[model samples]
Target: MTSILQVLIDAFALGSLYALSALAIGLVFGIMRLINFAQGDLITIGGYALIVPSSQMVAELFIGDWPWVAMVPAIVAICVAAALLTERIAFRPIRDADPATLLITSFAVSFFIQNLILLVYTGRPKAAGIFPGLSQSVTLAEGLTVPGIQLVTSAVAIVLLAGLAFFLKRTRTGTEMRAVAEDFTMARLLGVRSNRVIMLAFALAGALAGTVAVLLVAQTGVLDFRMGVFLAVYAFFATVLGGMNSLVGAAVGGYVVGGLSVVLQAFLPDDLRPYRDAFLFGIVILLLLWRPQGLVVGKAGRERV
Candidate 1:
């Protein structure tokens, strides 16, 4: 029972990270059928934004050294601006392009951000000691212990999810977003300014990515140029598995994927443990074959044009 509880904690923490990441991707994908590969790079930018770009072993904390109240907003603002800028510059011209074109554009954007990181940070991983206070584990019920990170992450995710749900259900901008997600052409015809809606989506995605970066550095204590790339990938899978068009689905998918991963790690034998991803992916493939529509299908679920 204790073991089960521990696994649950682990899963929730991991899921929280993935859920945030997936939401970042899903937000952009919802507005434009384009997956922003640079979403992960936004995360790297947040982590790297912490330290002065250095080739040396010890990284000098940049904004990371600031008080928590200041540091958090700074990261979020920077990344959100970056995201909005990317939409304006890189993606705007190709807004009407086909999925294949958008896919390539996303790849280009990913590479572009990575190259910038390499040029600045020299491709070397740096130790990031952000929010070290969260490292300690707190005792829970019946001798069980949970890492402060796990609790914080889960709470953050839940709060964000609730806030997002409220925004989508109640706010004007949120209504525009849902309208755009439902049918961009129709929404544009119905008085929705496409550019404004798209910009909002990018901003939201950037905020989510920034938050993930903060949590990521706290969890890993290490920063790397490509750190967020796989996270972006998994989050994409989460969106697909949960229901690409549904933000809630993406969130659920993140939890499911994260939970399944911990479960796999716990059950796999020592030798097979290293191949955990392979097995997990195999399961995903088979499941996809069975339910190609995903676990949760959005009302506007069909693949958009």
Candidate 2:
């Protein structure tokens, strides 16, 4: 029972990271219907943003003897900038293309960004400035163990998800965002600044990915050049499973995939672990076959204005 409980707790934590990445994917798809393959590279960008800073100001606050209130703003600012720049440079030019063309362009952008990173930074992994306590575990009553970082990750994820839900449902910008998502050309024709909304979407993606970068770096205590590739693939699967156009669906899909992956690893035999991807792919195939639209294809229709 303790083992099962531990698995469940761990799954929740892992799910949070997946959900954050998936949220970015879902948002872009919702607005443009274009799969931004470059989304994952932004994660690498976020990781590098947190890594290459020589001052270590944010790192100091996280590890400081005093409260860490100031770190939040700094982190948010860096992430938002990274996101907006990515949009301005990579996505803006291809805005008018068909889905296939945009997707290919996204792939090209992903490689170009990654190569730029490779040219600038060593291909080696670097240690994050976080404390060693992040990986430490605590045992609850009846011998269930949980990692401290996991709890922190889960808390941040829950807060972000709640705030995003509120932003989408209550704000005027959110209403305009929805309008753009429903029909970008029509929305533009109706006086909505589609470019601005699209850029905002990219900014949001960067912010979310940046948050995930910090969490991942904090949890793993290492930063690598190639970290984003794996995460991007996971986010892709999660978004597809949940529903590309549905933010809620992406969040749910992320957790589901995370939980299932962890549980399978924990319970499956050694030989079977190698087949995990195949099993997961099979599940996704089954889901798609069963429900072509996805778990919850948001309420927004695809009609152009």
Candidate 3:
């Protein structure tokens, strides 16, 4: 029972990361119907923003040395600025383009960012001591030990999810966001400023990306150029699995995927352990075959304004 409980805790912590990433993806998709794959690069940017650009393995920690009070807001601001800039420069011009065009643009922008990082920082892994103090573990009842970082991850996830729910349900800007997500043209007709709503979505997603970056660096204590790739990929699957059109579906899907992946790893036989992801994805395939539309049904069709 203790082992099972431990598994559940691990699962939720892992799920929280996926859930946050998926929410970022789902937010922009809701507003623009564009899959901004470049979000991963945004995570990379967040990671790089911490230390000064250097080819040396032990890159100098710049802003990362600041107190959390200052570090977080600064990194978040950088990501937010990048997101808004991307929206204005890349997405706005192609607003009327077909989905395929937008997708290609996203890929282009992703590579652009990746290459830019390579130019600035070089393609080398660097050690990062992000919040080293979070490494401490806490003992709970029944002698169960929980990592402090995991606790922080879960807490942040729950708070953000609850706060997001409230923002979407209660605020005027939130209502505008929802209206834009449902039907862009109609929302604009209803007096919702399309640009503002879209910008807001981008900013929110940027903030999520920044948060993910911090959580990842804190957990791994390492920085690399491609760090955010798998995260973006997993989050994409989570969004699809949950139903791309619904934010709630995205979060639920992330949790389901996170939980199942951990279980598959924990319970699989020795030889098959290496193939845990393969097995988990095989199950995902089965799940998708059974419900291609998604675990939760979403918008029937997306129409352009």
> Which regions of candidate 2 deviate over 4 angstroms?
53-72, 301-305
Q: Residue 272's C-alpha lDDT in candidate 2?
A: 97
Candidate 3 colliding pairs: none
lDDT of 3 at 108: 91
Tens-place lDDT per residue, model 3, 22-140, is: 99999999999999999998888888889985565446899999999999888888889999999999999999999999999999988999998877777878888788888898887
TM-score attained by model 3? 0.95
TM-score of each: 0.96, 0.90, 0.95
TM-score winner between 2 and 3, please give it.
3
Q: Rate the local accuracy (lDDT) of all candidates.
A: 0.88, 0.79, 0.89
Can you write out model 2's per-residue Cα lDDT over 37-99, one digit (the tens) per residue?
787887777666654433432222232222336544456567688678867886788778889
Per-residue lDDT tens digits for candidate 1, residues 97-159, read 999899898899889999988877778788888888899989998879887988989999999
- lDDT assessment of candidate 3: 0.89
Best candidate per TM-score, number?
1
1 versus 2: better TM-score goes to: 1
